[model samples]
Target: MPTTTGMKGGGYYDANSKEQRSASDAFLPWLEEAIAALPEPASHQQSWNFLDIGSSEGANAIYTMNRLVEIVRRQSDLPVWALFDDLPTNDFNQMFLNLFPASTPALSATDVYTAAIGGSAFGRLVPPQSLHLATTFNAIGFYETRPAARLPHFILAMHPNPGAPREGVEVSTSELIPFQKQAHQDLCHFYAARAAELVPGGKLLVQVFGRNETQSTGHGLMDVLNDALLDFVEADMLPRSFYEAFVFPAYYRNIDELMAPIREEPELAAAYRIEHAESRDVPVPFNTAFASTGDRETWSHSYISFLRAFSEPVLTAALPQDLPQENTIEKIYQRMERLLIDHPERYEFHFISIAALLTRL
Candidate 1:
């Protein structure tokens, strides 16, 4: 049998990650271009190695991997072996099952090999100088672990967008730095690890839910979740300490923030050449549906489902160990559903993403 749940957050992130899927779709051209630009495999190499870290159950991950193998087939005859990786808790059976007879039009060839590796991206999981190309899509916003400091003000590290109208909520800039610093170190470490694993001319494409000039990918969703947490607290359903200790470990960085280390830090600067980098506003299907149909119930359900998919695991973990974690989580999501269904106007969600293509220098 395969390891754990395919998609973390209880197999919820994949179906509800419409925003992430949109980001990958929007960034596909760049991904294609990056694949085309990869250096030819060395004469000593046996196969072209490709990897997707933080791929949740190979949902979007499989789609992109199929395309990658297809592109490489057009350019090289070398056998392609793809590695799909995520936390050990992630369900990998679906990813393995989907490897053959690719979801894409091409690359149905039998020569391609597929496998799953379970681990966090922060550690080295591959051999030295083995990978030819690597990609992580709509992931990496999450830290391996949360900072020890309490986020008493909000559930997420960054502030909710001002355009989002949640009255009486004050965001603390003081709370942002620890997470930002940790994220930077984490990214730098990730690059260093990849640099060691990738051949000199190997390529990496990274697309993540990210920040822009005005707001972040998480802007309004976090706001609603924040309010819901407080409501639970006020209702005596959750402990004050739970609220204080909980901060979404994810940090969505702007393109500038993403580039800081690759452009400035001596080690990363030397290891990678920035091939492509851009921040974009990706479409949200529920938001678009809400705008088009004026159907609050459908939209609210979609919205809350998306919220629970990514946020539920951490939220459930925040509860006291003795608490009925699953039941409590369900109730909290129920409240979240109501909150959005009743006042869909106030909680607006927009998906923002940043994508970059890098070359191992």
Candidate 2:
């Protein structure tokens, strides 16, 4: 299985993160309300700390930071310290470039100060009891590493047959248990880390992909891409070994799974209280645009571009280091685009996001 890393290409993510932006926008109203409800900080403190975890390319970060500044200023004129955190390899340059454009002046407004911190959110990214409010969107699903239960086949066990293990094979129930356990542990760790960093009464708002007991969360996007891969394998256009070995390092947790850690663990329960937790349906923007314009080709391109932006790095890393990296990546996306164009109805689906607001005790 491939290890979790930063997003693949900065340019693609910057351009194709409309879905992420929409999700963030949806949560803004709730965030604004929460900020308004927060107790005023100590009089001695001159600034408030706002941290944005996994701020991919600053597309949403720009809006989030600006909105936060607006809300915080309502209570006080104190300057706000906005910090953006992500993996070390993340495109910090692009993030800052977009955040503060060349034509505009620096983000040195007397009311808000901006800085980028490169690190993983799984660990201590900031000083303990320093941050007042924390926000993460569409990034919590990426665990620190792949689970120990290594399925030689796909990243997720979605195949029909559960008992057998072959190239591109299904995983049995016994084999899949480790992944679930690992996910629970990963979430607990993330909460613990954030709990340590946040001050008493601090609030954390998280927007991540989720599913209920009877649903699959990628909104059928992963299934469609999986089918495209299966077609390439059958046609011998790509090696079966390569296809089987490729695993995307992400896991979508349901509402129960997300709350389990806090509910079951004494320390986590004591440290945090769930203020609001619910699932929301996130419609696909590419599908909406296609519906309005009636352009299948543009929709396919946009959908493929979004997927490729996130998947390319993981897929490329999974391939053998000795293999030539010429047009191999392009071909995979090309085939995926063709599959979507052939069946446009597959694009019509909604992604479920579990939005939770937790306050430190």
Candidate 3:
């Protein structure tokens, strides 16, 4: 229920179609490039291991595993272990197994590390000095805001927000701040600790949504929905804190915002360098059919759905009194359809984004 000034996190959406796949496709080449920047194997006998943190659905992890298998199979017969780590509640383990079911005997073996890394006070999920390569693709921005600023009614306006109590809601900032600050502190600690875990020559490749002095946010399905949320609030359909709780969590940091966390840690300051930090231009196509209307019901539904996909956790945690848990999905759908039909052009159909790639120290 905490509130930061900008987007909180990435990769918290329920994209059932090929949309997530498409974004991954766009990310693969840059990932390959980042991996290439790592120190090369001195010999075919060199061993390597890969880990993905905050691995929501494990698409990127699987992709990286498959790619590595291909590379090693062609170059050397070295054994490689690929691990996908995330919260225990993350429902991606079975899906990841389903994706790489063959259990290839030659190239790599898959392992699942289901732990709540974010919940840890220190955020050290992987054991120290064990990992060789790690990649986190766009899932690090889920931050909590200042505890005092949470609101209850904002939940009603968040598009796609699925889980929340529909009854009367109330939250005290005092109750929310400690937990959120701990989470944020732990997250930063994780990157710093992970940097320590890596071998001297080992590399940690991070492809996160970041900014470069532009007024833009991040990328992907959630970004589009967040943009819509900003619109709804500005039009007076939703409260201002609604934007603070839900919309701000999904944004990317500018060059300074991206570097501030890492720079604060002296251990990482010397080891880490901006290996490749630049804002990227990502063109995204939003659902324009819903944007051209002013209908409250239609817009409400869209807003709820968007919130469910991107900001549900914050809304639920911060505004439990107003957002009941009963029949939430039905209400959200009804609200979205009403909003979309009312203003088909109320939202942007397509837009471009800025991104960054941070390499190991």
Clashes of each: 3, 0, 64
Clashing pairs in 2: none
- Supply the global lDDT for candidate 2: 0.76
TM-score of each: 0.92, 0.91, 0.63
Which portions of model 2 miss their true places by more than 4 Å?
103-109, 157-171, 322-325
What are the runs in model 3 whose C-alpha is more than 4 Å off? 1-27, 40-46, 72-74, 100-122, 144-187, 210-251, 263-265, 285-308, 313-326, 349-361
Report the Cα lDDT for residue 263, model 2.
92
Candidate achieving higher TM-score, 1 or 2: 1
Model 2 per-residue lDDT tens digits across residues 231-328: 76777666777676665677778788888888999999999989888887767698789889988789989888878777787777776555444576
User: What is candidate 1's local distance difference test score?
Assistant: 0.78
Quick one: how many clashes does candidate 3 have? 64
Question: Residue 140 in model 2: shift from native, Å?
Answer: 1.1
Candidates ranked by TM-score, best first? 1, 2, 3
lDDT of 3 by residue, 146-202 (tens): 333443333221222122222233335454454445434645665677776675556
Q: Give candidate 1 regions above 4 Å deviation.
A: 1-6, 9-11, 100-107, 165-168, 323-326
Worst 10 residues of 2 by lDDT: 157-166
lDDT of 1 by residue, 1-361 (tens): 2112224543457678776788788878876777787888788878899999888756678777877877778878888888888887766655554454356423365578777888778778798999999888866778765677767767778776676655555657887888888888878878888899999989988888888888687877887888888898888788877887777778889998888889889988999999889988888888888889999889989988877776766665556876534578778878888988887766877788898889999
Q: What is the C-alpha lDDT of each candidate?
A: 0.78, 0.76, 0.47
User: What TM-score does prediction 2 earn?
Assistant: 0.91
Query: By lDDT, who's the top model here?
Result: 1
